[model samples]
Target: MAPSATAHPLRGREQGNLPEDVSSFVGRSFEVKETRRLLSESRLVTLTGLGGVGKTRLALRVARDAQRTFTDGTWFVDLSELHDADQLAQAVASTLGLQDWSVRSPQSVLIDHLADRRTLLLLDNCEHLVGPVAALVQTLLRACLGLSVLATSREPLGIGGETVVRVPPLTVSAEPARAPAPADVPGGDAVALFEQRARAAVPGFRLTAENSATVARICARLEGLPLPIELAAARLRALSVDQLLERLDDRLRLLTRGDRTTPSRQQTLRLCIDWSYDLCTDREQRLWARLSVFAGSVALDAIEGVVADDGVDGDLLDVVTSLVDKSILIREEVDAAVRYRMLDTLREYGRQRLRDEGDPIALRRRHRDWYEDLVLRAQRDWIGSRQVERVSKLESEQSNLREAMEFCLGDPPSAASAMRIAAGLYEFWIVRGRFKEGRNWLDRALADGGPPTVERGEAMCVDSVLAALQQDTPAATVSAEEARQVAGRRLGPGRADTGDAAAVARR
Candidate 1:
């Protein structure tokens, strides 16, 4: 447990405002230390991360720890409840316990009060109030030489000379090859937080050899998010560890029991997400739900093709930027291309919204069609100088392509396109050394009850090639003969390329 602001009252020595932390603060020693170090070197330090990752808690802890550094004392102000930009200065002034009898503006009063004072202002939840916060921060820094601010938000305020630190989820242990020792169980920060919260909830809860593994699994599944872990730990009052794991896939419902003493928005996992969701514009929300279509990370072009639809009207890139800013989507660079992914929990939330507002089947069809075209383009580019580039792109989209294949093989099959896509990636499989998996997908699509057609011939050709690579001569021979028969039926022995493909497979 950390010392609350109430425990250390503001007396004659210190002259600023800070709140008492009601709940026990969990792991984040490194984040707190690094944040303080950053604040010392930079006038403005912003802690940025997705909701429920504990940016506010970490910011408070850092401010509390750095009380002695500022001669005028450290101040804490939460901006989540503040909505009006016009009242932003009043909020800050009120938090600092400032009394102004003069007719000066609130912003001016704040600057004048802190003009010669060395102090820290810790601002929490600034994403919704970025414009006003940025303007105020810039103005204060230029006017007051002794003022420093440590702020937390989903994104940076982007003020000049502001140092931004991205707060990552707590570290979890890697999946063990065998049952790990109880001593090693507490090594991970996420598991530590879970255990601490669990003990507090159940009073006598213990992390022995029996439940350590399952507890670690829960921590990892929650992606080391502090709030969800705490909520999940609270449920252990009734549910067993294994039962908790079973229900975690639908985590928004599973982790609803949060700290009752906290704010309404902080009382449940869904509400935390709702808070962030409500802050987004209509276009940003629509794009967020639509992006749930991706099975894994996707490039900018894929997002544009899939997300820019009727009812959702905005520049696709701009909407994506907004999502990234609000921490709904995570951006990463893969193979020199920018790709974005939603956390599994966030993706599930977006998927529910997508199903509610739009037709999931229609969206899936479009997704399948786009992936089919992607395979065909990769096939075309595989023979050119861009072969390496194409291979990388296909590798990144492999999960999405698999999703497309599953959609195609769904009841009432779209077998023709399925077979075509599976077969089109034949070169990709061979070049990327995934022949076995490719052959398995091709086998499934070929048997999916499509009428014999040119695509079947193409699939047979691909299957024959993969069979040859594995040195399965009998299977290769069978596939080659099938290709020849299909080619003969579809092209009447007139297609030279089909005949050549059949001959190569037979050899």
Candidate 2:
């Protein structure tokens, strides 16, 4: 319900160009109502959240619903593909069907045209050129009393009097305790969204008891985010729910299908995260790649220790803060300690960048070194009054420790470090009932056949202990004998190999 661009006989047909919704709008009734309320109270309302969180869709929906309030009509301008800030005003002007050939600036033209109209302008995807967009919006609002602007951005435009409404991912139901009939399932908005898209992708697809739980798992795994859910649902045309859920570990590659009419950046999960990545500064991008070494939420101290380097030149805190503002990094306060994390999709994208453009080996080695240091410190303090704190720290960093150990084991030269780390965690593994996991790491590291060293000897001894605990006497005896032989020889220095140079992509 947008005003027509054709000049009305009285005031020219309501002058607006809001695109029609191609697909059904999913649930966000609360968000829609809140955004509309803010629109009424303020001249400027910005919808902000992570990319692909349905800001544009919600904005468009609200615009359509509130069109009757604006006698002059509602207009939508998409800035996703517009990279040049210089063309920001021109883009809005062109979208409004402006045909002025005069030398006056587009801002002047827009101000003159909208001065007397009770118009609603919906600016979609304004995060990239937020500064320029903010300046323009301020100018237009000051010149036009009746104009109201609703913008969608990953971050807020920091202009005075701007109201920010964060659009969170759709609410998703917890895993059902028991599978029920489709009608009995109380799947939330995320399930409803997936069902709708899945039906379109595969005709007659229904939420039967057999697949309902899998569907719920799929939505939960996707964190109830809409774009990922939609992309995942599309795979139902070619994959079963179980298959789709199993393949979601590599979601960036698996969810590559999308509508052809949409922008290329939005056509896949990787590309969507890639769009956000591209908006970051060079240093910020480097930090993003380095931070990918983490498995889950990370404290600021951990990031500073592992990610800060001469390659990423800047105040690490500032860069981290910038990423948070841009929605590339999510900040949280857990137990009164600040931490940050990237979305799984964003982490995958950063990992790909690290492999393809950045020095993956160096960054990962630094990551390993940091975690290794933590493990060593924890071992030294395990027998004291801080034993509980040590245990808590080790438990919290378990995933990071695993990632570091995996990296060391994979790289031949770092096999000794891997053995050392595994040996150091022997008590932790035993206490945590991770006997099999400890043995697995030791086996992989010993299989690398590195030079005789105390580290390797320790690893073999620990492997023997774990094997004996598991009642594998044969393997335990072999490891114990190997440990004795390794201890008898002098350790040699490891040779380092240069990693291959990765080609950088031109911006």
Candidate 3:
């Protein structure tokens, strides 16, 4: 809900409650045109999509565009963080400049005041209380013939004669084979958007042929999703384009930089996804965390195997479908098999939830085990006719494998498991030319310095070989000597990493 009436003293009737845009509205020429056309034909129009897909922005743009058509005014009611359904009517009334002190109901005040006004109400973030919103909208439309409503939500209000428009991510160029010329940059909506936000973050930043490809790749990696793109662009204040792209694999952390003027929920990717996460039922929330184990799109069988446990005790398919309906999961088809996946930002949020509220170690171990068994199967079948299929399978699971290894390396007890997984991926690392990454993982696992074992020796040897291939002779020699020492005797454990104990001390 918005601030109290005193905080935002009632404005003149001409201003209404429409907020001025803090940043330029980027692409969506076609969306604006189509939405305006729909509003002309229908009294209720809903812009629906995933959170941070620019639904609110699009609705605002459309409302401002058609403002002159409404003789009374265009008022905006923000329901993004509002929880109390009973206050919904009062919130709308306040936004419409109504300050009735009588014992009359807020809904009654709104109806009587707007009965003859040709007003357009911009209802933002109505997904949480669709029932109340639908009822109120129905009442207003029935009473006020000149009234129109434009709503933004993850799903429809389910009202009769309502036009639902699904907003999509901005269009991004295909991954370029090579850096395109500056002429090609303006045509891509996502690239243009990043440039705009980047300029705001760093006034001197410009889209040049030299940096355009990196910007384009950044947008492509973010799937042309508006909020994430804006968040990424804001990082230009501290990070160069190359640094930004390299750090994007850990996007939830890197894209946290957001505009301060926006609401707290809109200030970071995690918070944006958190709003959606909070709206789910407990079962759906659990399923969401479990499904985050996968790296990319996952088949239903895999989802059921990983998520349909005792904790999530219901028809799993129904929960999956419900998540899709709520825009929490994206449903896709590959080779006639249906699969589901979360956006990278959403996946990271689910992973954070698993760490904060669930048994993250256990779930990550399960994820590792599942992928390990698949790797063994693929290795066994590599000699057969299905070798190509095996390659495809491993490639698809690459991110999952990396995530598993990351978890293993972090837990003290799982260092050996990390070494074993690193050993198993020797060939994959070579094929993908990821020698440096392979060496880094091996080095971390070996740093645990457990008792001398074959896994430790093998990991050291692999690290030595990778360092040699990279022409780091000193590191190669040191790693080779370490491998020999590991084969001979026990090693002292490394110091355990500390947390924010200092922060508590400071407080």
Candidate 4:
């Protein structure tokens, strides 16, 4: 066979120019200038934001643009695939396109080479492996003044002198003009971007007077977030602009399938997240869905309580830790422990999946039981010899426990469980310093009662603490007295009767 026309002079270099992977980035001019300014002055410039906001694209653009400023060509290391921090330096060495270094650690070798040389290092997707990434960046900056790094992530490296730039979503244009009188609304980088991408899919797909307003409106609703807009634009083959708009109220459903022709993960904006979830095993998936119950971050012990099915097979901590490694869950380090979170976007996606997969009554019952058991344990432990230790443990789990209690009392599974969970966590409130949370739980347990008299009375005692915490003397007096009345009621000498008496006033 003769040499083909598609063949290049250099083998691998030809394929590197593909648009989806990394090329001369087309848009993102505003980010380029800020990145350049940071790279020139700071030891480290970390570009941070929600995923798919185009951090890697912007970083590459900055690196290519700044290559001439350094004698050493820019080095790029992508860390998304690396879960363990130990691999950080090896990955960096390989990405510098470095080959011969068997004598020492790759990082040491790279540092030795970097000592006398000046280069721009572009580290992409560092959020998943931040601890290792931060340590390495700090080490490099201390040992070598000649090196500059442009890192992209969902959060910042805590290396001192690190300049953090948050990448905001793309700008949107005026609403799409689907009406007879076309309005001229102003547009931004995101609007111009949507038109450019749409045109790529269909010839002559420009923003004309006929549909310009509606186009802008669509972009704005999607938050001018590039990945979603691109996914939306790619769907033009199957649906009209109007149809896309009509269906977007449920964005997860509307945006599942994407331009298979696009890229593997970025095919659909939703699929970007779906890929992360698909990468998890069954336990991880269940943990992720249950994690949606938390609106903000929660501690590991809390997760362990709510999701006891953790281990190599169903270990809660290990599963959550893996999700954190995969960047599906983000951790905020404070004191000695790590607090973990799912993004608002991701949390919503998990919630939708939970609703689809879980039985509502059953889920609520578990919610009630988990917190009920947890608070009972905390209360018992708090009254034990290790009161301080018990209080700290309860405090750690307070947020999720509070969430479960509120879930129980608000529209709880059974009024019986609701009353008990609220009454249970009430002592946890005093111990955990969650006065407001406990009071809220107590109030709901009482106000929404179809609960038994003993449960309701125990709930009153719980409210007394809440009222006392807030300096509401009248309510405190009322609830304490109410508790005494229920507690003093004589037992009927049966197990059931004793159960009511026990609830009315704990031993």
Candidate 5:
């Protein structure tokens, strides 16, 4: 196939079917430029990402931006509405304004109609019909010179020479260097998008000095994904920023207002994730749900440790890579370790599946066990020159650790595990100045009533020291006495370490 420039120019007005976007378009300036460059070189360019990361919008905007360049026409065919692969070619033919009456196939009609015309077809939502779409695109490009196809899907079309652009979430400021002024708002596409939709939902809504940080927080929590941000911003008509943040824990339920004109699968945050979720293989589906056990970006080993089980059988890395290919997981390189993460929206959706199909409690317990082993390893490493590295690792794994600890505390048999984990990380708590948080976990674990094992004694010792650090001397004294009694009973009659534990607690 030749570049769009070499095709014959049509006599009539350019025959195009690109739809006009009713709402505003935000971000993807770089994506638009790169896509246009690729379209100039390749017959097919696919924009792939999670369902609501704005692939369709970016494809449309890019098509519109490059339409004038295609003299014959630029057209859009939304395959999202077409269910069967058999109906795919018909959909394309109709989009191209061709009505076939002869014995020729729709595919033949499309090829013959655009044989010499310089045309671009923007095919949206191809994941559901990847095989048919790939075949159609491959056939059309081979037969019709000067034809280009831009496709959007949850994964790549996997055809030879297909230029795949993985669309990313909108930009978010992870941490502001300082307090941001109104000037900073425009640069963060995620915040800018939130502000735009908020204004639409509530006429006077604006990101103010007081709420700018909150708005950024909201975006960060949503991982800067566009659909969630749009749904969140729309809630401003009824909920404040603080309220929205509070309700984000159940975001799938909270973020239900999608544009009425959009396909029904995109009508809510849950439906958007559901559409993607349904496309996965059984192993992929089970792994996706189990991976919700992670707190943030997960190292490959961590994923294997947590997700590999009897029911979910496969090479863990292959399953994970498949998820990445399907845009369910985002792979990140942090330090020297490769990690993968899901957007919170997807994570919540997966967590719900974990609850439905499998044992969330068992999975969470496994999650807790993995983190417990991790903390112990970090504790050993912290005593050496790798202390800084260990600290950074601890910080990175903080969310997962917290999740694990919470899991342990919530289950009776796991209280001992929580106590052991809390006791093992006393050094981390003290160095990081998280005495109160450590104390709270320790207190709750002890309150849950585990046996007076050595782990419990150690936890009591750490709790006493934490109480002392918080200036609660009476509570410190009481805890110190309890620690001494438990240690003496558990560790034998005259262990000097028991005295040391009590003295450290008092001091």
Candidate 6:
């Protein structure tokens, strides 16, 4: 386990900020220079960029460079999988041991304790939970006059006192069409990084006139990003650089190679992700592949909406929680709320497997029904503060929400399920200011005819409500009256549905 600051004292990725091997910092000289200046000038400095752009490495570089500026030495806090913002202070306190953070009010204890200490705080991976992390940062900076913080995130924390250092990908030169290896370009940064990664994969690998230009072009295509470069390099045992380049479309195979010696884990970046994936049983894999249908991070209950197996009744939450534990999925943080996400590369891997292994027709229908049903439930939960907690929980689980919706729009699942999910999300869509998305989904769902089911009436009712919300008062009145009339004729007076048909209509 890593030894960063956290409420429960994280057991992995936290044993320390990073390893002592300064072996991979081959090409980021410019980033290091400007980052040093930012740390020196600001109390809080955040290195922000897309995932795998070397933010963690840059932050570590700054901490190493800033070693002399601190009196108490530097402390690191890693919040990469932190799902709850309420746990932020406890996590910090747990790692710092500044006070008893195991209690319910760790933030107060943390503020009081940090008020007197002079130190450098290294907070890595702050993007997923910028709001809460930022809130904690604001509090800490306000109270701790002697503390300075250095963080890494994909985006800025947006706090008033924060100075954000935008970390771009490692440098790349244009690859000429059908490029040739340039033997004479000595000392280029791209060549250096490629040689460095290749050596890590195959001992003694180096740039020769024969492969130097080929190496350089591969790095350029990869944008000199370390993770992908390293992943590609790890395949050198079975692939020449050229062979690997040709197989870029099947990136999974290109990135992974046999490395049983490296703990059967951490063999390659692909292996690292795969170990996390394989640790999940078949069911988890199925759920993961289905969940990959979502883009970006999604809330928890979103899983409940999109992933129940059509062939059998399965426990969706248990499966999701299992993925989180295995590290195949990540629990994300929003201010006061926790969301979840699948890494982009992993999501791609899952989607392919989902298509290959799932029963296409059945899975599609199930996907539609589940999301359709879940959205209706979500709609009811959105209005009033009555189900705000549940609503947030839903938002957190689907980590792949955007992708899941795409699945709903195609073929057999279209129209009926789309209308139901769209109409149900109207209240939430409006409140969350998702104005355009709500209208799009509603319009798509209401476009034409739908399958006849117990859910039809409820879906129609939801459709009317959304129309009303969109300011069609007459449509709203007409739909509500139709719902009452339908209830009287179909359900009989005083024996009206408990809206159970809406639940079954999703069938």
Query: 224-285, model 4: which lDDT tens digit per residue?
Result: 67766765665565567777666664443445444333222233456546645665687877
Per-residue lDDT for 465 in model 5? 79
| Residue-pair clash count for candidate 5 | 0
Overall lDDT per candidate, in order of appearance: 0.74, 0.74, 0.71, 0.63, 0.74, 0.60
Query: Residue 364 CA error for candidate 5 (Å)?
Result: 1.5
The candidate with the higher TM-score, 5 or 6, is: 5
Is candidate 2 or 4 superior in TM-score? 2
lDDT of 1 at 458: 82
Clashes of 2: 4
Cα error, candidate 5, residue 190 (Å) = 14
Instruction: Write down the TM-score of every candidate.
Output: 0.50, 0.49, 0.49, 0.47, 0.50, 0.48
Q: Which regions of candidate 3 fall more than 4 Å away from where they truly are? A: 1-11, 175-187, 249-507
Where is the poorest 10-residue window by lDDT in model 2?
498-507
Q: How much is the lDDT of residue 314 in candidate 3?
A: 78
Question: Which portions of model 5 show Cα errors greater than 4 Å?
Answer: 1-271, 491-497
Per model, state how many residue pairs clash.
0, 4, 0, 15, 0, 31
Model 1 TM: 0.50
Candidate 4 Cα outliers beyond 4 Å, as residue runs:
1-26, 174-186, 250-507
Q: Flag the better candidate by lDDT, 1 or 4.
A: 1
Candidate 1, clashing residue pairs?
Answer: none
TM-score of 6: 0.48
